[model samples]
Target chain A: MAGIGDRISGTFFLVLGLTMYLFVNPNYIESVNGGNISPNTFPNILSIIIAVCGTMLLFKPTTQQAPDLRSVAITSMYVLLLVVGLYAMSKFGFEYVAPVLAFVIMIAIGERRLHWLLLGIVGMPVLIWLLVTIVLGRALP
Target chain B: MVELDTILAGFADAFTLYNLSFVLFGVVLGQFVGAVPGIGPIMAMAIAIPFTFGLDTLPAIAFLVGVNKGGLVGGAVPAILMNTPGTPDAAATALDGYPLAKQGKPLKATKMALFSSITGDTVSDIVLITVSAPLAILALKMGPIEIVALMIFAFSVLAGLIGNSLIKGIIAAALGLLVACVGQDPEHFTPRLIFGHWDLFNGLPLPSVAIGMLAISEMLRRMSMAHGNKVSSAIINLDTGNPNDQRVTWSEYWSCRFTLIRGATIGTILGALPGIGSTAAAFMSYAMAKGTSKEPASFGKGNIQGIAASESANSAVVGANLIPLLTLGIPGSVGAALIISAFMIHGLQPGPLLFTNQGQLVYGLFGAMLMANFINLWVGQIGLRFWVKVVSAPESIIFSSAILLCIVGVSMATSGIFGVAIMLIFAAIGYVMSSFGYSLVIFIIAFFLGPRFEKSISQSLALTNGDLAQILKSPVAVALLILSVISFVWFMRKNNQVNKADA
Candidate 1:
């Protein structure tokens, strides 16, 4: 799992760098500053570093001394599922999705009491809504 | 002479009912988070950032500055009471402090720590206010080249001397510099590394990155460590048969008066140097005291003087770290970095312009720090017993709570999905490194400084039309470069001496 994670993250950095170098053309530079260093210099620098570091990590990877496989797997799955739920709920409308997703995550993490889950599901969202809607006066998306 | 007019003006602004209340409010909240082991001032400030959004600028920052000050003192309480340190900086305090407690001198040790911390912090604040005026004047004369050199110096020192191993520290710093490179180049708006993801356009939000790297990873480490320990390790040793065992007499405190004063000065100077945090300051002071003390043998065994030096130095760092943040717009430590983010949220910037343009907020923040010390003294004493309880909370319960808070905190900072992804990735990396005794400090500091270094270098290059000689034209730049060389040599020599002494 550790090797796989490093591989994926490395690959992500590699492709990300390649795409950045390819897409941000000089013409775009004219819009920002009439052809100075391509606006892509900074990000390209980072991308290359990430790619290089990622590749090195993948090849001569540091020895793995992480936690037990069970915790890593369980935690990763839980986090991944939470992200998926967040997106799915946002598609259904963020207000409804946000509270529901939060509640479900709390419960899934082993909160036995419904009241505690309710705080996660209802209280947080409501408070956020109030702050956003009333305090900041920005409507909830 | 310290200008009374600026300070008086500051007091006027800070004395307002709203700001005063905020100062008290922030101190209490800051200490609450600081009392929890594995949650440091950096994480505390990051979590508090969002809450300052709608507040008036002065009050918002007043609250944050208060928190920043309170956190340093708050971290020491647990170190003295239990062997556990609430923050990495306080770990040095625990080395001698806990031993002192075991020897039935908890009160004296606690009182010494408090008094030394407050005194160190007070003197540092005076130094901060005085030194800031001159630094701000000097900062005005700097260009991109000088600033770039300074950042390089800062980055080098942080990576060079922080943690146990220099190699690991350098790696961590490199990682941070790399992270700073994310997003579009500020020089040109062409999106560089977003990879077509809109979310990546602004790069990673710093608060989320910090929370994930520092807080989430911390949670994982805590939980994993707990699994190995038996459940019974949770009970408190409430054997405070000597809560009053050895009161920190006026004479004892006075005896170590010079050490306390020297430690405070060292902490202030270190804190003023960017990227050197309170941990280094505390350890440096402890070493200084031990080396200079006639009874050096008592260092590890529970010396009140050791506790005094460590706690005082670390606490003094709180005020001194703000010098760079306020004068140069560069943070000196992780907590100061987070505090800068809060300032941005409040529509304030900490630079030369801050003194001239937002003088009120700048001085107001200084005033808040003074008030925070007083509040921290009162609140910390009252809250010590409760914090002692928290240190003994069941591992199962504490770990669970930490995990939950980590999840919520990270998610909230990023507003949902993508941020958590970044955090989990780093958590894995951090966990792997920690198990090998590799320093995460390098990665974290590197990630934080990467962009700054890049920006300064690129900006300087642009300004000088790629002329490298431009870097040497500025006296400050040349001086900083020289300092960097000196620091490198000094650190290497020190490392060699230690290794030889061990041999």
Candidate 2:
């Protein structure tokens, strides 16, 4: 199980390193000033190190404590939910999206009690609003 | 040497009502999260950093220090009462603590842990106060080549010493350097890898990256562990109803004085070095205590000194880790790294120059640290019962609220929605890295030190006029580089031996 994940991460980093070195380095990192040390020198060295390490890991992966696939999937779901929820908050004012976000995440996390639901949905966001706006004098998105 | 008036003024600044109250709040919050499973001080510190933007520097830093100190004390509670340790550093505390709790002496175990924790932390802080200024003055003598070599040593030790695989650790650090290169290069101020996004023109916000990776990823991991029917939180009954188990008498406390001293010594020595964190200190102290004890068989079977050894060592690390951060601007752990950013946020640099430039403020931070130890002692006495109760907050609600807090914190710390988006992305990256057993702490440390490392490299290059062989001109640089190579080989050999034994 651990080897599988290690191998995958190795492949992932190898691809990432190659992309950064070949594509990102050429296009994104422009040489505005040429000095003794080029602007891209550090990153290029980093990318090569990453690629070499990734290659080493790919060939001879060691044992590690990898999380189960179910756990990873659950966390990924939470991440997607969070990304979508924050995007919704930006689209519709935080006042509207926040409560729903709170309510759904609460349900997803297995909160079934009514009072806790009401408080999590309505009370928590209001408290945050008060703290951010009224107390700190900052606006929430 | 610091002036008497400067020290006196720092005492005055730290003793204010405002500073005291904030420190108390920080301690209370620290204890709360420390007792609660699935959350730790780094997570708390990450979320709190953005909130402290409006506060004065001393109070803000003092509060975070309080949290870190209080966390060590509070971590021992869950380790004692339940078999589950609240923080990784507290795992060794459970060996003796749980047995003592099971023997109907929960109060005695907790009180002993709290007392020894405060004692060890105080001892470490006193050393920090006495030695830090001199250390900082000494650090001022190092040239750019030496600093660069020292940074290399830090990287080698951190990547080689931490985590299961040195390769994975280095990969994480390399990725951190890559991400750190996203903003404009320090030399030319020309953008390197912004991908045409102007928000990243100022670089990825530290709060977004730190909070997302440290706090949100941990929360997500905890949420994943919230199994069916286990999501509500563990409820352990602490009512043994024995009067003899309610307190630690002076004799009981004084009996383990030597053990506390030894633990504090081990912790302070290791904590000052980068990459050797409190968990290692705690376990090392526990092993040595058991080995040297007169009654070695009583170690895991309710020996009081075992608790003292583990708790004191872990707690002492909170103060001792700051020695490197304050003197050399190198963070030994994630907590110290966060404090460095807090200092940077407050327009205070943490290197040796801070001693010469902000003498009074530095002393004030010292004063606040000492005051927090006293406050932590007082609060731990009163809040032990409260912290035990705080651990019962449902994981579902706790993790959800943590996610919300991370979003809000990053948003407020940076621009509103854009920062939140970056945080979510990093949170995902953090989660994946976490799943694959990479050390996110190493990544953050490398990311935090990346700019300075790059600057040192650039400086070294310019000084030697791109002649890399000129590095040998400085004996100090050569010595540090040799140490780096020696440590890397030593760690790799040790790891191989351990792996072979396990296999």
TM-scores, all models, native as reference: 0.80, 0.97
Candidate 2 residue spans exceeding 4 A from truth: B227-239
Error of 1 at B438 (Å): 6.6
Instruction: Kindly list the per-residue Cα lDDT of model 1 for residues B1-503, writing each as its tens digit.
Output: 22567767877888888888988888877676666666656666666665566678878877877777777776776787777787878888888888887776766666677778888888899898778977887787778788778776876687566654343444455556656655766666556446567787777776566666666666665554444343343344544565456467778889989889988999999888876778889999999999999999999898888988998899888889889888888776777777776776565666766877777667777787787788778877776666656555444444444444444445555676567567666766666555444456556655655655676777787888888887667888899999888887777666556545544
User: Could you give candidate 2's per-residue lDDT for residues B332-362 as a string of tens digits?
Assistant: 9999999998998888878888888888888
- The model with the greatest DockQ is 2
Which 10-residue window in model 2 chain B sums to the lowest lDDT?
A: B227-236
* Every prediction: chain A TM-score: 0.57, 0.91
Model 1 C-alpha lDDT per residue in residues A1-141, reported as the tens digit of each score: 434443544455456545544654322323354433555555455556555655554554332334466766655654565457545644664567666566554444444555555666666677666765676665343
Please report, in order, the local distance difference test score of every candidate based on alpha carbons: 0.68, 0.86
TM-score of 2: 0.97
